[model samples]
Target: MTNATTDAMTDATADAPLGRSAVFTILTTGYTGSTGPGVAATVSYVHDGDRHVIVDPGMVASRDRILGPLAELGLGPDDITDVVLSHHHPDNTMNVGLFGRARVHDHKAIYENDQWTDRDAEGHELTPSLRLIRTPGHSREDITLLAGTTEGTIAFVGDLWWRPNGPVDDPVSPDRVTLRTSRLRVLAAADVIVPGHGGPFKADETAPV
Candidate 1:
C-alpha cells in the first residue's frame, strides 16, 4: 500500500476506476458538531456496469445536496439500482425512500419493493467489484461496503472511524474490543476509507487502533 497524506489520498482515489468500470463519488461530505443541532450523514454514489448504487443516503442539510450531484452525473433517484445502508441508524437511512426503485442492502438482507430476502451481508457481493463485509462497531449491525478500485480497495465504513483521525473511542459503540478488531480488519483490507461522518481518507498507520 502506498502511504499517502490524507489530501493526496483523496485526490488519488477520487476518480480511480473500480475493477474495470466501477467508480464512486462522494455526494456530500458530512459533519457532526461537538453537541446540539449539527449532524449530517456522508453520502456516496457507486456505479459498476448495471449497478447504480447509493451508499448511506441519509440526513443532510437538504435533499439537493444529494440530488444535485446525481444530476450532474446525469442521474435521478429513479436511476439508482441499489441502496446500501452501513447500518440502520436513521441518520444513515432516512433518505432511502428517494430511490424507491432501488433494492436496499443492509447487514442482514436485501429489500426490494415488498419482497424481503434474508441473507448475511458478510461476503455478499453486489457485483464483482462491490461487496459487503460485516464490521460491527458503531452499531452491532454495522457493515462496510468494499469496492475494488484500480487505486486499491476503497471501504465505505459507516462510523467505523467517524472521521479519518477517529474519536479513538467511539462514545456509542456497544463493544470497544469488537470495534477495535473491526478497525484493524478494515485497515488491513482497504487502501482508502470513506467514513460515515466525514470525507474519504487513506487507510494507513494513522488510522486509529
Candidate 2:
C-alpha cells in the first residue's frame, strides 16, 4: 500500500514487488504538429501477477511510447487480458485495436457491441472484484473503472476532468449536472484517481465541488 512516481520502467520494477498489483501511468505528450490543441494524455495499466489490463491505451500517435514501455516490463499486447476503455474519446480509446487478443469493454451506450454491455443505474461488476460504474457527464457513455488494487481503490476516470493545469475542468461537457454528480461519486469512491489526462492524484486533494 505504497505510492511512488517513476519515469522509467526499470525504476518501477525495482520498487514494486511481485503479487502486489501496481498501477503504471504511461504519459504520452499530446500532438503539436499544427492541427490540434496538443493536450498531453496518459495511458494506465494494472499489472496483476501474469495478467495485465490496460486502461485507455491512448491515441495511435502514442503507439510506441505505450507499447515500448510494456515490452520493457515483459508485457506485449498479447499479454493484455482486457482493454478497458473509460470512454470512446480518441484520446482514451484510439489505440484499442492494437491489442489483438484483448477484450475491449466500454459503456454499451457508446456502441452496441457484444464485447461489453451497458449496466443498470446501480452499475455492474465486470469481475468479482472490479466494478464498472456508469458516470455520464463528460460524455453520455462515460464510465469509470474501479479496481481494488494493492494501493486501494484505483479509479480510472476518462475525461472526468483535466488535472495538469491545477484543477482544470473539461471546458466542454454535454451535461454539467450529470458530470458534477459523476465527479462526486468517483471522489467518494476512489482512494486514487487516475484522470484521462495528467498523472494520478489522491481523491481527497482533488475533490470535486
Candidate 3:
C-alpha cells in the first residue's frame, strides 16, 4: 500500500489479471422502497484478482443482514481491503468506518487529496484499477471502472443502475430518451454485471447492469 498524497497516485493499473480473468462478488445489505426513493442499500465486494475490494457498506441493517452474511463468506468487515464508493450518499457510505485498515477510494473530485473519511480515515488510491471511467449523471462523483483483462472487459457502473434489475431508470435518465439505449450499450460489453448491491449477474441476465 502507498500513501494518500497526490504523488502516490500513479497512472491506472493496467496489469492483466493472472487468475481466471477477474471475478467480482457482491454482498448486499438490504433493500429500500418508498414513494420518494426506490433505492436499496446494497453493498458489495469484488476480488479484482489483485485483492479484495468492498465497494459500499450501506446503512446499518441487521447484523445478519449486513456484516454477518459477509462473515459467512469467509469475509468480515475487517477483511475488506479496499472500499470504493459510488458517491458520498448517506446510504452507501454510512458503514465505511468498518474497514479499519482497508483503503477507501473515490474519484479525485469526491474526496480530493485528502486521506481518511469518517470511516477508514486512512484511505488511499483514488484510481487503482485501469480504465476507470467517470460517468457523472447520478452525481458529480459517479464513476465506473472498466477492466480489459481476459474476463472480457468488466465494467462497474457505481450507482448508474443502483440494483441491476433495470439498466437506467428510464424516467429519470436523460429525459428518458436514452435509458433503453444505454442499457443495451452496457449489456453488449462485459461478461459479468456487478451492481453496487446484491449479487453479480451474467451480462445478459435481466438483473441490474
Candidate 4:
C-alpha cells in the first residue's frame, strides 16, 4: 500500500478531508516493503486536532521495529485516542487490544457488540462527520469509512484493494458483487481517502465514475 487513492474503487468509502497540518507522526507503520520474506506490517497516524488514532497495527513479526520509528515522533500506544481496524483479518487485528483504552471504531459489518461479527451489507453513520460504508467481497465484513463533507473527506479502506498495484478482490457471492459495484459509485464521488494499509490518497485517482 503506497498511497490511499491507489487502494480501490468499489468496497470503499471516505470521510471529512483532514489536512496535512493536522497529521502529526506515525504512531507506527506496522510494515513497509512488499509482502512475504522478512517483511512485516507498517503502522501510520494522523492528528484530528489532538484526537489521535492508529489504524491497522501490524503483527508481532515486525511491530516492534515500528515502535522505534514512532518513538522518534514522540508517541506511544497510550497516546492514541482510538484504534481503527481495516477489517477482521488477524494480520491487522491480532494485536488490536494491546493498545490503550481507545474504543475501537470499525464498520458495523465486522463489529459485534464488543466483538467482531459478520453480517449482510448495510451502511451506518459512524460519527457526526463520518459515514461507515459497507464493502463486502473480502469476507463480507470489509468496510470503508466516508467523511461527511468534501472539505476533508477521507475514506479509510481496509483490504478493499492492495497496495501500489492490486484490485478489489471480488467474491463469488452475487449479493456482495452487487454491493461492491454500488459502493464504487460512491468512491468516485469522494474527496480524500485514508486507506487501512497504505498512506492517504485524494479522490480522483481511484474514483470509479
lDDT of 2 by residue, 1-209 (tens): 12221122223222112222445545353332222566545777775544477888776455787888888888788888777787777767778777878767777632223544444523555454466777787788887877666777777777785552323345567877667667766766667777777667787744553
Q: Top TM-score: which candidate number?
A: 1
lDDT (10s digit) by residue, model 1, range 129-172: 88788889889999998888766788999888778779888888
Pairs in steric clash, model 2: none
Runs of candidate 4 exceeding 4 Å displacement: 1-39, 109-131, 147-151, 168-179, 182-186, 199-202, 205-209
Q: Name the TM-score of candidate 3.
A: 0.63
What TM-score, computed on C-alpha atoms, does each candidate reach?
0.90, 0.74, 0.63, 0.62
lDDT (Cα, 0-100) at 161 in candidate 2: 57
Ranking according to TM-score, highest score first: 1, 2, 3, 4
In terms of lDDT, the best-performing candidate is: 1
- Per-model clash counts, in order, read 0, 0, 5, 23
For all candidates in order, the CA lDDT equals: 0.85, 0.64, 0.53, 0.52
Residue range 1-209, candidate 4, lDDT tens digits: 32433455422433232332344344443333444544334355545545566666656465565556666777777776766666677666766765656656665543423765554324554345544556655555666655444354556665554342323443323355554553464456466555444555565645322
Candidate 3 global lDDT: 0.53
Per-residue accuracy of model 3 over 54-114 as CA lDDT, tens digit each: 6667675543556776787788776767677766677778777777767666765333135
User: What C-alpha lDDT, on a 0 to 100 scale, does residue 194 get in candidate 2?
Assistant: 78
lDDT of 2 at 107: 79
Give the C-alpha miss distance for residue 120 in model 1, angstroms: 0.3
Off-target runs (Cα >4 Å) in candidate 1 are 1-20
